[model samples]
Target: MKKITFLLVVFLALFSCQKTDSEETNPLLNAVLYMQQSAEYKALTLQIYNNAAIHLERALADKNWTAATEQNGDYQNLPPAVILDVDETVLDNSAYEAQLINSGRSYTSESFAAWCKEARAGIVPGALKFCTAARKKGVTIFYVTNRGNAQKEDTRKNLRRLGFPLEKEIETILPRTDSSDKGKRRAEIAKRFRILLLIGDNAGDCFSGFTHASQVKRDSLVRVYQSHWGSKWIILPNPSYGDWESALFDYNYKLPQSEKLKIKRSRLVE
Candidate 1:
């Protein structure tokens, strides 16, 4: 009887330990883990949007200016427009991130689509205000996102529900159809309007060669466009996930979570 009781106690203790470890084993935790939970993130987002507002005014005054480096000088006479990434740039999907963390699940398209269908995403700190100001200035707002075209209606519903300005007769939201690289989409918009500024959390949103580039190549490309960082290309903070994380893993998505984590830790400078 004593031996039986001892074995039961050992089992209970082991179960308790396993439960605790499982609860704490989320690999998504990092310095930016509390970004949505912290005040600093809000402030930084506000600052970036405010700066964008100021730059937009300046760009409007200079009809000859085009934020898109790929755009030729002839496009200066076209109507003004701003290209923005929907996720993490204009929309606060931190709730989705929180859900992933709480559920101990990595991001999946189905889950993200379900979240979009719910349309519960809130506006980023100053996104609405900046976008509103840009619209009032008669500048068209183009949302060029990598979200699959299958999610188009839900994404539109979410953006419209959040009171984002959308074009009346023309579709301004461009979703991923064939490629993840947005250079072609940007060019398509550039042909119609003079792009004033490009805003996003990922470098790929603002420039080419950043989509699947290595860490070294990405850094080199950033340096190559050193002058465009703050002026024409406004980047929001998104440390949770992006091409930045993908670069750490050599853009290989097939790696197991454990291997990806190992690779990430190995790449850390500290």
Candidate 2:
């Protein structure tokens, strides 16, 4: 019995040591993971959306105001609308992100489609209140997302299930088709509605130039539009994933994991 007890202790100690080593060697401590798992992230999201609600009220009353820089002649004559990005903005997809981390896998279209088919995404904090307020004020809500059209049905179902205002014709949900850049789609929407505000987690959602910009270019663009940020564009916190990550490695999706990790580490200021 003593011999068996001694062996069991040895096994447990070895297993614990291996587990700690694995964690220390793993380089998947992404910002998205931290953002998704932290209570502070939830609080910040709620704060941003609550602030958006306040700004939405102000934007609606300002007839001369327009959020879309693409808006051209006679834009003020059109109905008021707000352009919003779907993922990580209005809808929370941290579960899908978490699944990738927990499973020790990267994001794949097949997995993403499977996750969307479940239609289980939850509404972001204060999103319902902000959208509901906009709806009540007769403002149109247009969701422009990079999610392909193949996921449109599931996306719509998920949004509707969460009590979001959805048009019966489903014209409001615009998914990516030929390109991921949303500037063209925003232009199309600008032709009809006077976009009051643009809300998203990515800088690309607001400006096409930021779509594939380098880290330095992105910083420059942000400086250029510094004034428009809080007034016309409400950006949510999405440290989990976005163009920012892609910019780190120069948007090279094919790079090996180790190479990407090296580049990411090299860019650190500290």
Best by the TM-score measure:
1
Q: Residue 206 error for model 2, in Å?
A: 0.9
TM-score of 1: 0.93
The estimated TM-scores of all candidates read: 0.93, 0.91
What is the overall TM-score of model 2 with all chains considered together?
0.91
What lDDT does the true structure give each of the candidates? 0.89, 0.87
Clashes of 2: 1
Candidate 1 per-residue lDDT, tens place, 181-227, comes to 99999999999999999999999999988988999999999999998
Candidate 2 CA-lDDT value: 0.87
Off by over 4 Å in 2: 1-18, 24-37
Q: How far is candidate 2 from the true structure (C-alpha RMSD, Å)?
A: 2.6
